[model samples]
Target: MSGVAGDDPRDPAGETKLTFPESWQVESSDGLSASVMFISGLIMVTRNRYLAWPSLLLSINSVINQHPLRTKEGGNSPISTVILGVSALLASYLPLVMIGPQKQVPLPVPEAQ
Candidate 1:
């Protein structure tokens, strides 16, 4: 070992060998997109306006973070996730647009004795 970082007696250069996992063994699925899709499904089922907006944003993030080059052949597309998210957003808001939001009236409660 020498004071210089690249100094190696046995080898010509002290460049360290790095081992990477095989490409086939690596997972190509995007967890973010999957979760976003799940959220979209929830929004569709519940028609929650709050969840709809955030789920749409998450879908956009998923699309932006997608790496086509890194993904394996025939991998799941982010486009579908975005489409689902957008549809969920539409479903949540369309009711408000069509019928408008109803004001909730609280029932009067009797005073406790």
Candidate 2:
């Protein structure tokens, strides 16, 4: 029997063959979103953070609700899930690393005659 990433074993070749395990997907998405939220929240806490929050929230929501945000679109593979999860987490961190640390500058002092 051919199995996809998150397909129901009972219906191996149904219309929803490539579906992910609801609970697993939810957990994975939540984990990914949480990681992303942390990274985003750390970066631009004021402006960009709010934008990033939705992706994180949606990711978590998708997981907890077991709702399929993205379709399989192909055959299933265990590695795919790992890749997806890791990619999501890593993608979030990339921006943080790119921004780097904020530079500090010492204030100039007036010279005494």
Candidate 3:
């Protein structure tokens, strides 16, 4: 009857019997990671569109990780390498986004005496 999180999952007293119906639990780590990526992506997109790219990629990876790969065609290839490379590539361009578009200024001219 004790519902404590850390309590032992078993009961030693035979006087009382408790039965739990079949149930399932999905671990939080994966879902949490994906949710975090998605939320961060949403925030970034709203605040700064360019910086959102990395978060988008990360979220995509999280999604992809959840599903089984289609056709084990590529054997011995490091799938993560591609994901990491793309993320890194996009992240590398983050500074460019921060700098934003460039503008040209007219040169100043001195008046002739």
| lDDT of the candidates, in the order given | 0.83, 0.49, 0.50
Q: Report the C-alpha lDDT of model 2 over 1-113, residue by residue, as the tens digit.
A: 66566567566555553675554232233455445445444534343434454555554554554334342434233344334444455556667789989899998999999
Candidate with top lDDT is 1
Give the runs in model 3 whose Cα sits over 4 Å from its true position.
1-26, 31-46, 67-113
Error at 73, model 3, angstroms: 31
Candidate 2: where are CA atoms >4 Å away? Answer: 1-74, 106-113
Sorted by TM-score (best first), the order is 1, 2, 3
Clashing residue pairs in candidate 1 (N, C-alpha, C atoms within 3 angstroms): none
Candidate 3 lDDT tens digits, 1-113? 86775466355543356787644434333543445455454443445444455555655565566433422343222344335434544555676789988899988998899
Candidate 1: regions farther than 4 A off = 1-25, 101-113
Ranking by lDDT: 1, 3, 2
C-alpha RMSD of each candidate structure in angstroms: 11.6, 14.9, 13.1
User: What lDDT score goes with residue 52 in model 2?
Assistant: 50
lDDT of 3: 0.50
